[model samples]
Target: MTKAEETRTRIIQQAADLFNQQGYAGASMSDIMAATGLKKGGIYNHFASKDELAIAAFDFALEQVQKRYVRAVKGKRGSIARLKAIIYTFATAPDEVTVKGGCPLLNTAVESDDAHPVLRERAQRGMYQWRRMVHKVVQSGIDSGELQPTVNPDTVATILIATLEGSLMLTQLYGDRIHLQRAEQHLEQYVDSLQHVDNLKQQESSSR
Candidate 1:
């Protein structure tokens, strides 16, 4: 890539980590300048304003998170396996791969709730995308008769997202992985329970 493109990408990468750690409002222009080793004029040369930069950084952070989720479920067949993989991803994310501070969706949602409209909207869209991914997996399970036909994909999605995000918050707050580990165990069991009774019986019979 050209120098200009490379520079812009570097700035976004630095700012994404900074904002994810310090938050949008908490992270001043000087902080970004320090993090990126660029002066005001140099940073502004790429991003028109702090608002613009914040949006770009958030998008970058969200993309990183989305990629993790995609990788978590990659080549995994069946809805239960995919969903469990997602939970495993979240549970192990603190040490595996993450945006430095924490889950961008959770961080942005909490920080931008009443202050930053643009960021709040971005977080909303990101959340929708994540929920939709989970929903599709659950729906596919139902279609394949692996999951109970009566299960609602939307509900399952909400439960998984809420539980995982909430557990992440606790884990971040206390600096302990037990909260996330417990949530992971619970979610795995929950996903297993979604399996169709007939499928469970068939597996039981096959084992005998």
Candidate 2:
């Protein structure tokens, strides 16, 4: 890539981490400038304004998180497996793979609620995509008869997202991974509970 393109990318990456760690109001232009090691003018040349940069950084952070989810479910067959893989991804993501502060969706949602219209919209879109992903997986399970036909994919998606994101907040608040671990365990059981009776029996028989 050209120098300009590379520089812009670098700025976004740095700003993403900064904004993720510090909320929109908390993250100042000087902070971003310091993080990117660029002067105010240099940064302004790339981004029209702080709001613009914040949006771009948030997008970048959300993309990294989405990519993690995608990679986590790769090669995992069946809805239960895929969903568990997603939970596992959130539980085990390393510092490099994860946004520096925490879940971007959770952070942005809390920080931007009714405060920043653009960012609130972006977070809402990101959350919708995430929910859709989970909904699709749950629906697939129901279609394949691995999950009970009566199960509601929308409900499952809501539960999964709520449980995971809430647990994530607790994890970050306490600086302990145990909260996430507990969430993983609970979600595994919850996912298992969604399994169709025949699917459970098949597993039981295979184990014998």
Candidate 3:
């Protein structure tokens, strides 16, 4: 990459972490400058304003989290395994570990509410895309006969996202990992409950 491109990426990454830890309004240009070690002119050269930088930073953070999800689910077979992988991944994702805050999407969603229209829309879009991804996996499982035919992919996706995000908030609030762990276990059970009868029976028998 060109030096300018590298600098831009570096600014985004640093600003992303800053925004995640400190809300959009809470983070100032000086804070960003500190994080990126760039002067005002240098920052403006890459981004027109704090608003533009925020959008780019949020995108970078969301993309980083998405990449982590992809890595966690990679090579896993079956929709059930892949779905569970997502839950497991969020429970202990690398980005979360490094950020020491929480899910960037969730953070942005909460902080940007009724404010920062562009950033808010970006978070909303990320959520819709996530719901679609989960819905696709659930539908695929049904099609493959791995899950019950009556299962509603949309409902399952909504529940999974809600439960996971809720748990994450509680986990961060209480500084307790158990909240996330419990959510993971419950989500796993929810997925297991959708398994076909024969698959469920086989799992039951194998455990014995």
Best by the lDDT measure: 1
Best by TM-score: 1
lDDT of 1 by residue, 3-30 (tens): 9999999999999999999999999999
Q: lDDT score, residue 163, model 2? A: 91
Worst 10 residues of 1 by lDDT: 91-100
TM-score, cand. 1: 0.98
Instruction: List model 3 lDDT by residue over 1-208, tens digit each.
Output: 9999999999998988898989889999999989999999999999999999989988888887788878877898999999999898887763356453578888988888676889889999999888988998899999998999999999999899999999989888887878888999999999999999987888789999
Clashing pairs in 1: none
Candidates in order have lDDT scores of 0.94, 0.92, 0.88
Candidate 2's residue-wise lDDT over 1-208, tens digit each?
Answer: 9999999999999999999999888999889988999999999989999999999999999999999889889999999999999989887864445678888999999999666999999999999999999999999999999999999999998999999999889988888889889999999999999999999999999999
Candidate 2 overall Cα lDDT vs. reference? 0.92
The RMSD (Cα, Å) of candidate 3 is: 1.8
